[model samples]
Target: MMKYMKHLLVILVITIPVLYTVFLFGYHNQTQTTVIYHGINLFRGEEGGDQPLFEKREFTAPLSYVILLTLTFGIVIAAVAGLIWLLFSRWEQRRRLRSEKREERKERLYIEGIEYYFQGDLDMAEKIFEKVKARFPAFISPYIRIADIHYRRRDYRKSLELLDQARVNEAKRVDIFLRKAENFLALDDLGEASAALERAAEIDPKNLTVLEYQRDLYIMREKWEEALEVHKEYVRLVKHRRPEMEEIQNRLQYEIARKLVASEEGKGKAIRALREIIRSEPRFIPAYKVLGEIYVEQNRAEEALKMWEKAYKEHPEHPILLTWIEDVLYEQGAHEPRMSELYRKALEKSPHDRLLKLFYAHYLLRLDRVDEAEALLGELERTGGRLPLFSIFRSEIYERKGRFKDAIKALKAAYGIHSFNEMVFSSGNGLFEHPLHRQRTVSWYTWDRYRINTGQELIPMPDIQRVHRA
Candidate 1:
């Protein structure tokens, strides 16, 4: 009801003025007055003739019609001006809404492009970013994002070109310089990368990301001291230390120590550095391993054994340390009792560890404890152990026991699991069905060739050799 009333009021306002004008026109003629004039000669003959030749008549309108006409004209002029103003206001509103919608579309595209970029779909991200750039030329994010994509593709020149376009503003942005630094670093232009990063640092001195980039640059140039300083700065700025930061610092020290170990004079320095690393991070196994090796090279057998034993006690699952310890003990002719006890104790601690069980079984075999080794191998087989070496060891156990058929079966199983087969066709063709095993045989041959080219050790198959001889 209110809506109808509002519309009706508008119609009334417009119609009232027109109706009043119509009423005034209708009544004006009825109320209008006419005046007539008669003139006589008062001057000479010329004046009398001029006066008689002319008779004057006049009509006068009422005051109401004159006022109505003036008022009607004013109303029409005001209505026209109001209409124009209303139209212009609506047009302006629509233009602003269109601009807002365009901005919204550009923002959505940018967000999608970022998602694709992180998901590793560089091509799709580039296309979307390019569309955004075309549609919204002043939106700087798309230009920078596209440049980053080009940087990832290693198209450094194209990346720089896009970055240049993004840098049209007078003041340089931190992100723009950071991206330039990344591109220069990828191209191995360390000096330019450093310069760009420094400029970024100047713009935002406390930025952790810029500091991280500077640290990486220092590491790349092998300036460990500088890298460490920058890393410390980064930690200070971030206000919280990350575990990886410590690891990176430890690795930097390790490398420095490794380089020092090259000279006899620097061996002492290397040892001191290694000791420092171990003191800081006791669980750092590589430092202990290297330190043990250094002791062995120096003929300090007792020292090497002590260091390795400490490492094994700390991290019992480290197979390399176990193997190294076993080798050293065997070389010293003291492996039988000591190494066996060590393996048994490790197995007790980590009973379900496959690598530990396998190593223990191998150690048992070395000690001529065939029954124990066979029991472990049986457990491995039942539990679906897929390592080819497991099958190979099982075959070895069978051969030692003089179970020729079982030995052959185990060898065939090992062959099936074996990744490389350079000798498969040459020595074991009788074991495999000719046509059925064709693809498997070819795949094995290809793998064998790859292993040989890559200098990987081939899997041992002693039973296959015996079968070939038979």
Candidate 2:
């Protein structure tokens, strides 16, 4: 009703002025003579006669002029409106096309960047990514690609900076978090990596990728307790949502067992965890290995030997079993008589391994068979490369033969390849005795002090010496 009233009012306003003008012209031009009714004159002129006072009234109305003016003004207004609409439409189309072109160019650059990355041309990839970023400042692909290039080049710090620079809207924040976590993991920054994963979990707690990364980070940090907690969270996350996720379940169970054993402060807990893992996954060699190590650490050499024997029964071609057997026998003070037999058997099993030959040589030297050890070392030298322990053992052999210079040279060679930090090695029986312990202190900040301590101890500075020559 209100709409109709408004329309009616508009129509009255438009027609009133024209209608009044027309009425005025009609009244003046056409005389309204009073018609006599019963000899009475109505609306008469001033004179008594019909045309006495008012001479014959004659006026012209320019109706055609008004009609022509109205049509001309209507055409002009219509033309102006049409021109404005056409200009606006053209501007809008141009703007849309520009946007579409920009999107296409960004996509093309993104593809090119990916290709360059795959080709292992990180420089080219970075260049392409920068171009994409310049062309499409709103695009996320460039940041991701550049970060990946940095990561692949092992410039982890730069990669992390790139990841931090990534822009993520509400819709893409979860993805950004996951990618950031991946970059942190690549850099071995477990704490930050775990935090990123946790953020991703907060966004989408049921995300399996995020959960897996969290678990992996915990494991990398050697935070077995935290790893178990993450495992439980993962279980809760996927509960009933993916009931058929058997692979996830199995992996979670295995990792749980591993973590339980790792965090165990007592031998009882370690043994229990190991037994549970074996029952769950009979073929898990790591479980058996850890159990044997725990036994050995506790001086239960017989039990450790039996565990290795069982492992050997399960896997007949296991070379590490022989290594363990030799270790146990050496610990039992039976290395002299059994050294030759063990070396011969191990060599027969794996003849091409230089490390095996080196170990055999060490045993031979300990047995006072210097000539035999020399022959083995010579054979090892004939091969292409040296084993991790070969140089140290060789140095010991040289020192025994009263060749102090040769002994020092061999020790220098060993130090040059893998710098042995005295603090790290001395604090807790060193790398070889307890390799897993090193995992807990993998941070540069923690290990940096160890290297400083090594420097203080006057440990050989082979790297520094080389730098001086250069």
Candidate 3:
């Protein structure tokens, strides 16, 4: 386009000057010429001179006719130039259209590759894309397609080689960089993967896919600090926030806080970040547990108890909170008053809550409040059927009251266990234990799901504080 503009400018530069000169020199009127010629002739006639050369002026026309003739000449020249330019433009446009049509025809084979790819005929797709690659070398789609086929076939090195070729053909292709990064990640080449992602980010900084990939890469490398930063940007750029995204952000934030807590210098910042997470995500039970531990590690028992109590009061189903609270108070023999009042208040709020009532029963039995514990057990059995933990809790009551034989009878009858062993109980360690590691010990928390990590897949907590507040 700039070339065409320069040519037009040159034509204008030459034509305007010539047209201006003609208008300046050829602007003569016939009246002025006639007066001069007649005056000169009259003088000659008076002097008896026969000068036939002074008859008229042939070069000058009338004023209006001169203007008309000049306009006509300009119109003729302009028409000729305009026609030539129009013809040239049409020819160039046709040439471009033909080239585009040829490219489209080459892509027709690419369409067959796509059809075969979706049909799961990878071998044919590979062949078709290879042919397309040879014919349409400038375009990166065929290379991308072939690389994808290799990736599906688990030929990661081959996939990467094709992607490298694509990158050479089109260095600015973000998809090429993304695919190369993926292939590198699959091959466990973090250095190459990082380089690819860095290039992609430089090309398009705000790309959501690039941000997600970076976030995952950092997380896989256990670079919690970097992962947190990338995840924050990802969350900010997301148009619609999803529950899974919230969960991911929570995990990243918690991982960072955990790392901070691990370092002596970062404990205070970790505490602050954990508190922020707890405020925004009250249902996230791990944040509460970790924050409590941090306080306990510093010998800040009072603060830890207060924090755990605050959380337990809001979410009674999370047995971990109850465990943390009672374990602190039980050793000192001061759990009665605090735990009693807390359970009373929780029962008042959720009176129909069987889990809370059952937890209170377990606490009572552990304290040797056999009568109250028995009453709750009977109510639980009558209203909500019996759980294995219920039988275990009853045995706990009998054991607390010095009825060892009946405790053994109750456990054996409920679980049909043939083994015999001592059940060591501790408020801090566990509620019940098998004698020689032959059976799984029952924990004081008596959590629902067994055989998993502590505090995992516990009951879903209440929604006093929802997610995404921050």
Give the best candidate by TM-score.
3
Per-prediction TM-score: 0.54, 0.54, 0.59
Model 3 residue 193 distance off true place after TM-score fit, in angstroms? 1.6
Question: Which ten-residue region of model 3 has the weakest summed lDDT?
Answer: 461-470
Q: Model 2, stretches more than 4 Å misplaced?
A: 1-139, 142-168, 182-191, 228-265, 278-286, 296-300, 313-317, 334-355, 383-388, 417-470
Rank all candidate structures by their lDDT, best first, as comma-separated numbers.
3, 1, 2
Question: What is candidate 1's local distance difference test score?
Answer: 0.70
lDDT for each residue of candidate 2 in 426-463, tens digit (9 for 90 to 100): 11122123232234332211212122211111111111
- Angstrom error at residue 122, model 3: 2.3
Q: Is candidate 1 or candidate 2 better by lDDT?
A: 1
Candidate 3 residue-wise lDDT, 1-470, digit = tens: 56766766787777767666655654543332211233235555555655763566346454544554666688678868876887899899999999999878887888888999889999998899888888878878888888888887879999999988988988987888888887787777888888998999999999988887777777667787797788789889889987767666766677788888878899998999888888777877778878888997899978999988878778766655776687778865788788888878878877897766777787776776789889988998899787666776777777777788887877876566765453443321354433423332211111122212221363321221111100
Lowest-sum lDDT 10-residue window in model 2: 461-470
The residue-by-residue lDDT of candidate 1 on 1-470, one tens digit each, is: 35544755696588787868766775856565444455543554754654554545555766556556667787688667766766787799899999999889888988998899889999999999999989888888888888877876779989988988998842468888888886776676789989988998998999887887777677667677787788778877787776767766776677677778888888898899899989887766667767776887799978988788778788775645676687677778899788878887887888887767876776677667889988987898789655555766776677677776676666677566443342332211111222223342200111121122112223321110010000
lDDT of each: 0.70, 0.60, 0.72
